[model samples]
Target: MTSVPRRTLNEAVTRFWSLAAPAYDFSALQRWAYRPPQDEVITLLRDHKCRRIVDVACGTGILADRIQRELKTEQVYGVDMSDGMLRQAMARSGDVQWLRAPAEKLPFDDGALDAVVTTSAFHFFDQAAALREFRRVLEPGGIAAVATLAPHQPPLLSRFIDSSRSLAHNPAPDEMRALFTDAGFEVADQHRVRRPLWTRMFTDRITVGVRSA
Candidate 1:
């Protein structure tokens, strides 16, 4: 597979989300489709006792703010490529240190984070590079959690979605697990999740991995 130029991908994604940032939190897609998995990812992070965590592609800082409050830590950070998104995120929490950065090039020291989580935005990432960055920043035994769109059922539909102009790649749960493994993480869990209403056409999944100590 050919790699997208990092600069081009960053520019395109940043432009798109920057324009959408103003109304992102109010969108039905955010409230209905993305919220459930975000809640789940938060629970997982809390369960694992992750106090120093960063939320990647953290649009409007919703998940990162929640993580900060729930975990009661000042170590929460939010990273996104869109300036508009970071601006909105900054308003959500004074505690969360919001940074404008891409998923593949996080601006942090290696092994500086206890956990890394990205929800509803992984499909827009260069999967391998993002995962490697996740692993690189996480301390040993730190967790990496991802929640993203599931591959459409019926191989044809999945292929169609992959080939769409959206520039997203929805991997099956197994493929996601494999990605974690290939990125040097120990695959800890994998499961499917769906929205309350559209349990069929739109689906999501969670994959958790642990860096070795």
Candidate 2:
């Protein structure tokens, strides 16, 4: 697939969330496609005792809010590229540290976070840079969990998703594993979880990796 110019793509994404901000929550687009299996992902973080957690691409701050609610004492940060989305997130979840930032260039100190969670947002990121940045911010032995739509899909539906104008490329299992390894992370786990989407089964996947010391 051909790449869209970086600036243009960023602008388009920003405008998209800006325009969709108000109706983002109510829209099926958010619930049907964008949301991930966050309940289980949050369980993973809690089970691992991750304290400093950041939810990358935390649209409207759902997962971040849930994380804050579940682990009351932990620090939960939400980062997104659109100010509009961050605004909504801040309004909904006042305690979360909502920042306007890109995934590839996070604004955090090196080895500062205990865990990094990306829910349904990895496919939209510049995968290579995102993996490197994730490794950069996480502490040694830090856990990283990425919950996203399945890469392998039914043929026609897969084409529909791939051809979608706003969507990005999805990496197959092997590619995702390789990305984590190349980013200096140890691939610890990979699995699938079923999410209900409009009465249909969305067999999403998750990959957990650890940043080596």
Candidate 3:
């Protein structure tokens, strides 16, 4: 498959989300659809006792809110490029530090974060650059969780994938693993989990890695 140009992909994603922002909060379909799997991801982080977390590509702060509530850490921060999405996220309850920044170039010091988590946003990123940035921001032995829609998934997810065909750039699982490994993160766990497709079609794959100390 031919790779999409970075400038074109970024522009498309920004425009799509910017226009979708107004209707975004009203999309109860997104909440019920994504909550279960997001909860599962949070559980995984809890199991690892992750705090001082950075939620990369954190659209609307769903995962960031959960991390703050569940972990009760003041260290929660979120980064995204879309101002519209970031505005919606800031409106959400919790003191999450939201930054308008791209995942490919995080605005944090090297080895500053304890854990990093991203949900449903990997496919929109420049994966290699984003993974390298994740490595740069994470402290030694810090955990990183990157989740996105799996390829050839159920119809529910396939619809979103198709709708965003202009913007979606999902890499195969092995390719994702290689990106992380090449960035100095050891692939600790990688797998798919099933969840109810409540609204807006929910199907996802999660990858967890640790920065080598």
Candidate 4:
């Protein structure tokens, strides 16, 4: 996946989201697996005193809604590569600005945002590019809080999940922490958490990186 088929991949992603849009918020299992971690991640952002923020790859703006309602963040923007996803997001949270854009190319100016947050979408990103873009948009002392599936579990479980994963990579907590440090954010926190889907448990990581003040 070194040389990603950008156009082809983008089309596929868009098509997938478009189909998923109608029932995205209504799915019980999807909400169970993703929403719990989202609550914790939003708490992490607020604890860092993040004022202005962008939720990159913000699918349906669920986190954006929470950022506004919980953090009372002055300016919250949501960015995603798929228009269909953004459309659903815009509909759900009309006040927040929803942009259909890739994470590797954000619209914000250098050092323009106080914090950049993303969830469930990191592994699908071009890692270096996306991290660079994150660093580029963050202000000094800014934070980037990412919540995603962690590659940690029983060996057989990890192998099977990795094989079925659609993204380029699913990094362990250490790998993600180092990636943040390398991208100019000073690593502040990294830990694993779990969300349950009825009988199954899903492991995840919440990694926070802060730019030097």
Judging by TM-score against the true structure, name the best candidate: 1
lDDT of 3 by residue, 1-213 (tens): 126778777777877787777776565656665665577778987898877889988878778887898888888998888888888899995589999888889999999998888887887888888898999999999988887776665665666664555456676789889989998999998887557544424456788899997
The clash number for model 4 is 0
TM-score per prediction, in order, is 0.90, 0.89, 0.88, 0.88
lDDT (C-alpha, whole model) for all candidates? 0.85, 0.82, 0.80, 0.79
Question: Against the correct fold, how does model 2 do in TM-score?
Answer: 0.89
Measured on C-alpha atoms, candidate 3 has an lDDT of 0.80
Give Cα distance to truth, residue 52, candidate 2, Å: 0.3
* Residue-level lDDT tens digits of model 2 in 1-213: 336776676677778888877887885766665554787778888789888999998888988998998788358899999888888899988888999899889999999899999987687778888999999999999998988767666666577456556456778888889999999999999988656745245657889999998
Error of 4 at 27 (Å): 4.6
Task: Count clashing pairs, candidate 3.
Answer: 0
lDDT score of residue 3 within candidate 1: 62
Worst 10 residues of 2 by lDDT: 194-203
CA displacement after TM-score superposition, residue 176 of candidate 1 (Å): 1.2
Error of 2 at 99 (Å): 0.5
- Best candidate per lDDT, number? 1
TM-score-best of 2 and 3: 2
lDDT for model 2 comes to 0.82
